[model samples]
Target chain A: MIEIILGKYNYWIYIALMMIGFYAMIAKENLVKKILGMNIFQTGVILLYVSISKVSGGTVPIIWDKGGPYDNPLPHVLMLTAIVVSVSTTAVALALIVRIYKSYGTIEDDQIVVINSHDGDKEIPSEKASTII
Target chain B: MIELLDILLLLFLVICAVAAISMRDLLSSTIVLGSYSLFMAVVWTRLNAVDVAFTEASVGAGITTMLMLAALSRTKRFEFLYRKKGQQEDPNKETNPLLKNWKRKRFSVTKVSGLIVVLLTGAILIYGTMDMPDFGDPNSPSYTHVATMYIERGQPEVNVPNLVTAVLASYRGYDTLGETIVIFTAGIGVILMLRKRKKT
Candidate 1:
């Protein structure tokens, strides 16, 4: 039990973080809150991947003249790309949110849907109407 | 011990995430989320992931927060109340002013369905982690795979001391180019969406 507690506690903490983000992503009403939850979730996954590359006595992936063990480099390479991709996704999502606010006058998902149906029932712009459908 | 520090940092991360989600004020939530990213970077550093830590600190903590605050400034400032205020609907709208969207009542099955989806995801994640090798086992499959090859061979071939840089910029050069293109496309998409066109 002590070994389990001491050795694998990192995974447990990360999993907890992941679950928290999951709950927030599902339940949060605000679109901005959903984005925050997404950042948390991405960080958790990044942490997990980085943790998988850890070596007990190994140093960083930088090779020195002294021959020794090193932490895994493959996961680092992969996660570097993932971290950048996360930011790009966030940027596009936020841009979409801004556009939604401009057209519908609200960022809430439910309200946007309400307006879309209401707008459809009433007179819809010829081009914008097809785009909505 | 390192374990204790790790525990404290992870605890703080969890607190930040929960607080960010629960805050009704969008700006405050964005700030807390930034701090959460900062904590995540620290934890990555402790795990000896220098490159990952650096990226998370810069992109996650820095750029992500700026973009979120920008979006917050553009959108409705506060959360719209969703729960049915049947009996205790506040008469004075001046006290807690909300945008006009608060009038849209939605109690569809979406919330319950969302709960079910998240619970299933959590269960699958927990089960998946059970078979993963214990923390930092040198004999784990990950350390024995392409990582070893990169450390042993890629360094001398590319003349880069850092195996990560060598593999990322050389061995996986094509993949890096693809990622760059993806980021470029995203920037273009954002600019297209946010720019205001002048009516002549």
Candidate 2:
């Protein structure tokens, strides 16, 4: 009964995490909050994949004379690449944010749209507006 | 039977996701997202698909969150709500007080359509999952093919116990290179979008 409960618990946890992230992304008005939610959602995917890779009583991927079989190593390698890629992307995204902040004095989405659409004739460049600021 | 550790890890993922979304601050969300990705990377370790896990950890959790935060910093921190009370006067229409120099416009249909498209794509993904194989079964066709090949001859061919790495870096080296190119393209796109033009 304990084992069954534990198994059910794990399943529910994964589902809960997935839902939380999804809800946050959908409901949050704060741009940063949405991004955070996205992170949560992606993490959920990672958890699901990792959980699926386990083999009961399996040794680490390293082979030894006493071992029956080794745990799979493919997931680890994939994850390493993923980590590196995520960091690189983060760096670029942060750079873009800096640029955005420079251009728009305000980070409120509706305000920016209001400012941009006010020009009924000539198009105003975001850079130009920021320069004026 | 799986170990207790697996259950705990899954629980952790749930907690992080819930907290990340529930939190009011965007910065905290991004950070939680990063943690979420790192945890997912660990999950990849548990699953035998080390390569997929690596991609998820790096691209999904790491780069994606960073990109999102950067986008937020440039864009509006808060979404605007429309006001209805003050438009009664023909000559005294209330221009936006917040953006004194700018004009205000209502939300467009394009944005709504774009959102609908996103919802449809998500629905498709959920539907696709129904046809997938149930977890890890040695008798499954996927297990018998390339997955089994790696399990059987991975040590001999690449001398690496991690079959995913061997396959990604060696047998499917070209594919990995292509993936790298795609990432490069994304970087280029962000750069292009943000590039400042010099005034003549």
Candidate 3:
């Protein structure tokens, strides 16, 4: 147990981060916070992958000249794509948040759902008001 | 694989993540998340994954935070609590049941459900980690697999000097091409979603 805990402390730290992001995504009412939580969660996973590729006596993946125990370049290549995709995803999520705000005047998930629930009972005025606002 | 410096870096990372999540001000949290990415990038560099570190610094710290701030500029920065009595998404929808039931708030279903899900996930992840070869284990599956060949015969198979660049462009050319298309689609999606239309 002690060896598992101490020898693999890196995994535990990353797990803590992943849990933090997960909790925020679930518990936060603000839409922006949720987006940021997603970012945090992605970064934790990225770090986990990068850590797995490390070699104790290795140098960087660049092999321009000399040779040694270079770290696995596969995860690094894969995570480059992951990191870029993460950014693009964030841009899209933010765009959606903006649109949601324009339609509902607030981005809180609960409040938006409530507005939709009452829209049926009072339909026309809500439509007109949403456009006017 | 573990060092005192690495331990300190991870410590700072956890602290930043905790601060980013716990803060009520969304803007502050966003910037704190930026710093978390920065530190994580540094750690990746220390792990000899410079290419990953490069993208993390540029995309994670730079573009992600900029996008967050842009969104924040157009929205409220503080969290909305259920206890706030009169504030509503639509004033026209005055007869909302949630408003009437505010004082009688039975429980937050999302929070409880999320906690249950996250706990299960974290437990599974921890268990998964137990089976993974220890950090810097030379004979690990990842190293023993094609990575050995990549290190041994990389120079011969691909003319590119940088192994990461060679593998990314040559070995996984098709995957990277698909990713480029995905990014282009995302760019178009953003423009369509956020671009203001000329008023009719």
Report, for every candidate in turn, its global Cα lDDT versus the true structure.
0.81, 0.55, 0.82
Candidate 3 chain B, run of 10 with poorest lDDT: B87-96
Write one digit per residue (lDDT tens) for candidate 2, span B7-60: 677677767776665554556666776786677667656654456655766677
How high is the TM-score of chain A in each model?
A: 0.85, 0.67, 0.84
> What TM-score does chain B of candidate 1 reach?
0.86
- By lDDT, the best candidate is 3
Question: Model 3 over residues B1-200: C-alpha lDDT tens digits?
Answer: 47889899999999999899877678888889999999998998888988888888888999899999998888767665544556554322334355555332435888888889999999999999988988788889999898888877777889777889888999987778977987898899999998999999
Best by DockQ: 1
- RMSD (Å) of each candidate, 1 decimal: 4.1, 7.7, 5.0
Full ranking by DockQ: 1, 3, 2
List the pairs of residues colliding in candidate 3.
none
Instruction: Name the regions of candidate 2 deviating beyond 4 angstroms.
Output: A1-18, A57-67, A70-99, A108-113, A116-133, B41-137, B194-200
On TM-score, who's better, 1 or 2? Answer: 1
lDDT of 1 at B4: 78
Chain B fold agreement for model 3, TM-score: 0.86
Each prediction's TM-score versus the true structure: 0.88, 0.63, 0.88
> Which sections of candidate 3 miss by over 4 Å?
A121-133, B82-107
